[model samples]
Target: MPPATATTPAPPTAGATDRPGATGAPGRAVQVTWAVATIALVAVGTVRAAGWLFALCLVAAAVTGTLAVTGGRSPLGMLVAATLPPAATVRALSWAVRGLRDTRPAGAGIGVGRILKSLAISAGLLTLFGLLFSSADAVFADLLTGLLPDISPDGVVGWLLRLALIGGGLLGAAYLVSRPPDLEGLRPGPARPAHRLEWTLPLVLLDTLFAAFVLVQLTVFFGGAGHVLRTAGLTYAEYARGGFWQLLAVTALTLLVIAVAARRAPKTTRADRLLVRALLGTLAALSLVVVASALYRMQVYADAYGATRLRLFVTTVELWLGLLFVLVGVAVVRLRAAWLPRLVVGTAVLALLGLALVNPDRLIAERNVDRYLETGRLDVSYLSGLSADAVPALTRLPEPMRVCALGQIAAELPRDGLWGTNLGRERARRDLAAIPTTTGVTDCPGTRRW
Candidate 1:
């Protein structure tokens, strides 16, 4: 100090270092890779008809983009992560706009305007030269024609609009990678616990109601179709259909009730935790029975008629709801649910992906075909109305039925370019090509049962 000694400043404290935006920018390689992946996925998946590949690719692109921007960091609460995308996207867009308005380069990197200007100039020059060169030579022209996509005048505007949207989205996501948002800040604080009787009484009453419903379902299950006809004064199919919708509502409402009850229930003491577990666990268990009953009803209905898209979709939803009940049961047992939100979201995503992979339209067609084989009744009109995904199964039908079932789908099949190519469509086209073309089928035979 006497010699005016220069001292190194103390390093920033851990708390300061861990603050939002304190982490350095995401790596350049990561940003570039994410941009390419997102653009390619959206372009390829959506440029064509949406199918299983599109579904899978869309999810992948969203996850990749989210991870890229946040530097692979996720919130402790997965529910928080689930709600972060819209807010994060808005914040990123705002940051990007601010960046563009800044005169100086951020850090040692090129300024946003400069980079954008360079890109525009390069693109213009490349397009101009490429066009001129193509005009100068036939061989070169053919090569370029093959290499470049042929966008018609009518479609050029649409294509450009898609490009603009994709580009804007990528820019926002890229900036987010460079400056990760404070995800931890988005986590919600714990809820206030309700009074012991406040939560307990409602839950106990709900559980009792669920118990009564479950007992009635057991009676119905044991008594079979005869009892349903005798009591309900309707055919088993009608009874099943009516009961399914109501049971589905019950399952959904029960889940909501459980969520609200769990949030407000006290768990500070052993007695309170035990009571919570017993009440909520009983409710979840009864809800599972309701889910089963709903499924049984759907099975009865589908067997009476045949599987349709709506039937299959609702069945899947029911199954997912059943799984949610199981998950809630697990959470009830553990008395801690910090992991439940993420697991719930993950299972839903998996369920959707599973549906896509199974090819629901094809499954519906196949089930109906099986039913037709057994009962000698086919809904040719319904089969014909399905997407290309049903074509392969529809081809399995006999004679005029096959022709009628496939005629609309075959007529509607578009000759997709490289970007528009889809697995289901490709399979349909190939299957159609393999079969002999049949004509003169005026109308389908069967009427829709639904």
Candidate 2:
């Protein structure tokens, strides 16, 4: 025997981890759970009409599908993880098709083709017997009719098409779950820090600019309407509208600048880290003021001309941006931002879900209606264009305004099937049924667009 020699195991090959049974593959039970979840989420669309409910279903499906494929083990940033599922689903389609094609039995296992054939035969026999019994007994026929779904000939093609598309998508997702991609390998190397002068000067200048803007904002806040009219030679609404978009742009650009500065700032020493925190932290704090100013401008604008979708949406976005600034400030203090990416994405998803739950259309209608009661200024045409979600609120308006606001919505209200029903539309239908249908208002006052 050769004098004791040490043996080393070979290193795993590239992409080996992406294969089935590899470390990245989800366990069988996990796969089944996620698969069922995915199916249930997709099935929601077949049952619910498009609205907030559909939006929620979409979000759930995306999350569950991503979790299934990545096994929730992706090392990539949350932004990348959010986008990976769709691409993975598309890439796995061919693999799923090939799998279905090659269905020969392994060892003592049953063949897929044999199982499918047995199922087909069993279904055919059951159908034949069902038809024979239906002709033999009227009560049995009625019971069978009640038990089976009514598959109309007109909708059979569409139903089959939907089934095939959803089935194919599910199959692709299943394949990806069994064999996740090498996402960890795709994560980029750490960024190289810029030279001190390279990143420092821009950030310092930005801080100075933000400071100047904050000073102006302070002056405006304390100065009030008289100062704005005198200095800018513009009314409150004019001033608000003029600067709102510009301030929004500035806030967005400031966030980008902070991100770049944080990424490029060197942190090799305590002094460097402290400086980074001081500059970026101040910028984020000032950015919060800018967010506040943008929101205040929108409030003035909405006060001048009631609430609309655009104004409400922008306000929500500004609020989310304000929260982002707060998050950045916290991340800066800790000198550890690894959690920032995921938290940012999570907060965004929550914000969107929150917005949906609040029923934006309804909110908009309610705000406009309240403003009308106060200022006697109601935009009937605009309210009429709102979705069925606003029906309940719009119906609260006085006679002509209520009729005008609900005419279009009620006219366009779709009669969704049992599976395609939505709470919002159902409520709208019930409310509309109770109200008289005389088109009693030909010309609604304040029909002008704001």
Candidate 3:
């Protein structure tokens, strides 16, 4: 999933770099100062506004810390939702620390190993940062629902995620309570299958149930052969003609394939194994491609329109990905075919390709600026080069250029929005109008007109 592009605090990190004494001391001191300041402010706030507000923040922080410390699996999500501003500040700071994590080791100069370690650590920090933001966002409860009038907010899917987290935690706790004695009791042994039918059976049953849902949905949605399966006076024909039916049909097919494979017995033949792997691989790849394509489309829509497009539920593609994951999970449990593993590999490849096609690098660069436009970091340098080579072309740009090429041109305009984006924008508007629907709109792709 695309990481939240919100202005978060620095990425998370251990911040254990061994830097010069001077720099390290000052940096550490600054951090300490900030921490002290935060604590003091909170304390003062508590003392002055010691009523429900201070008590609330304290209670909120305590609950969040408790949840995190307890390994609540869902993270301190509720706490984050309650304090988004503070969370954003802290998260941004965390990311900043991660970016500066490899500044130096005063005693030991940079080395190959250090370089690699730094890279790994930086990536890990960023990964953690993303997770933190995602978890925080997930806890929205209903704060945003009030802001967005179009969305119903807090749908069935969100309920599922919450339930899963809570159930998993409970299951983990139960397993730990019933776990067999540890290494001290073992004279000698290698790893054994981690689970038996007790675990496997339930998951298998769940797969079966999901597969059944898919099948029923398919019949209802597809109305294949125009066969109407109606209930309660609502004809399947009426429902199946819409987009929902097509999606359900596709999803149902995927589920049936998984369910069938799961119910089948495993074979020992090499050829059989290979075939199974290939089929699974292809299925997985296509699924991933669909997901990537969907995400890219959402990104485009969001940029062209506004983030409000995804204010409530995520894009359709994301939901499809979830369904895809469930389908694969079913397959993994039932299908021992050699082809199954390849499905995941294919999904990875196809997803990458789809994403590349859907979201070209140039578009992404532009969108990045659009997303951060509020911050005044809308980098319009994308047009700088075009200006050089296409200088003449820019000057002669058509009228409609302003609307189509707004991304690149707007940034160049003064704060007062005067002068309008270089001539290209003006040209865009003009060209869009004069150019018929048959002709594709064009622009100076270069950053400058050399």
lDDT of each: 0.75, 0.75, 0.39
What TM-scores do the predictions have?
0.80, 0.79, 0.25
Q: How far does residue 202 in candidate 3 sit from its true spot (Å)?
A: 1.0
Per-residue lDDT over 1-450 for candidate 2, one digit per residue giving the tens place of the 0 to 100 score: 779878998988875554332344344454455456656666554433335445665766676566555543333533554676667668777775565576664676664456677999999999999999999999999878766554888567868887876676666566666776544455567789999899888888988988998999898788865686798789767888888999999988887888778877899999899999999999999999999889888887788788887788788878888998999899888887766764565566566556666778889999999999888998888888888889888888888888888888888887665545567788888999999646857887774754
Clashing pairs in 1: none
Instruction: List ranges where model 2 is wrong by over 4 Å.
Output: 1-64, 71-76, 106-169, 235-238
Tens digit per residue, CA lDDT, model 1, 184-211: 4565578899999998888888888888
Pick the winner on lDDT between candidates 2 and 3. 2
lDDT of 1 at 112: 74
Clash count of each predicted structure:
0, 0, 49
Write down the RMSD of all candidates, one decimal each. 5.5, 5.2, 23.2
Q: Is candidate 1 or candidate 2 better by TM-score?
A: 1
Q: Which candidate should be chosen as best, given TM-score against the real structure?
A: 1
What's the CA error at residue 327 for candidate 3, in Å?
Answer: 10
Q: What TM-score quantifies how close candidate 2 is to the native fold?
A: 0.79
